[model samples]
Target: MSPRNDIQNIKVREERKRQIMNVALEIIAENGFANASVARIAQRAKISKGLMYNYFESKEDLIINIMLDGFNQLTLSFDTNKDGVLTEEELHYFIDSSFETLKNNIHFWRMYFMVLLQPQVYEIITPYLEKTLQPFYETAINYFIDKGYEDPIAEMRFFAAMMDGVGLHFILDPDNFPLDGVKKKMHRMFK
Candidate 1:
């Protein structure tokens, strides 16, 4: 058989990268970023340590990628229209899907929050987090402005704080967390 073409090569590369990332996320989530070394991640991923570097420059790069992946997943439903504006329907959808994502990916979010709680890890990820989340932050603020809130920034802050609180509460106590009730209340309040 002929060797893999460029398209095939790209596909293989992406798949391998994804496999490595998925494994890293789980290991970091389970082991915490401080302890989840690149060698450990590579071992968990069943890939050679040298091969892991071929995909990511270093352990920091690997975790940054994983963190961004979770952040992207969290914001996947935001501004669905791609118009750079959050509509009413989009707000409701974001509220709805945010809960859905939390419910569906608790372990990942748990790790995401765990990483945030680590001061050193948070410091390492802060710059990237700010850069990665700036667009969504602006869009969310714009959303409040369009809604004609008296203090758009404050409103946005309140909404964000509440949402984060809900997510954290659910993560801490998924079994007893009134997920549906909170979702409905959010929809009502934001409605």
Candidate 2:
């Protein structure tokens, strides 16, 4: 058999890292962030303690990556073309996709909101999340400008807050969430 190439090796590493993060997220969701530990996560992931460090510098780093990835997953549906502006179609898509993501990743979202509820934990992640979401915010603001809003920044803030509230409500009550109704309303409102 041929030896694995660099690309294959990179894929392997990425998958392993993802596995570790998934386990950490599950542990956090089940036990809460404060109770989750590196040793426990590593055990759950079936990786040695030393190897876990290779993927994550520390528990905080792992948690930060999961949080950042969760936000990025939502933002990815926005500005799909990487252009500075967000079109109406993309705006609609973003709203729809955001709800879909919440429905599909309840555990991660639950853990995400749980972490944010604790002031100290939220403080640890605030800077990282702001940095990651900066570009997303810029594109959204540009979208509001294109849509002819008088105050694009305020418009952007409103959009963000709306999304946050919807997500929190869904996580709090997925079974009773009017997910489709909310998505349709958002689409209509945005368009």
- Candidate topping lDDT: 1
- The models' CA-based lDDT, in order, is 0.87, 0.86
All candidates' TM-scores?
0.91, 0.91
Clashing pairs in 1: none
Instruction: Output the worst ten-in-a-row residue range by lDDT, candidate 2.
Output: 114-123
Per-residue CA lDDT of candidate 1, range 1-191, in tens?
Answer: 99999999999999999999888877777778788898888898898999998999998898778778878887899899878999989989998899999999898788778776777667778899899988888898998998889898898889888988999999999999999998999889997
169 Cα displacement, candidate 2 (Å): 1.1
lDDT tens digits, residues 1-191, model 2?
99999999999999999999888877876787788889999999999999999989988888888888878888888887887778898888888888888888797788777776666567778999888888888988888887799999999999899999999999999889998998888878787
Give the residue spans of candidate 1 off by over 4 A.
Answer: none
User: Could you give the C-alpha RMSD of every candidate to the true structure, in order shown?
Assistant: 1.7, 1.7
Worst 10 residues of 1 by lDDT: 114-123
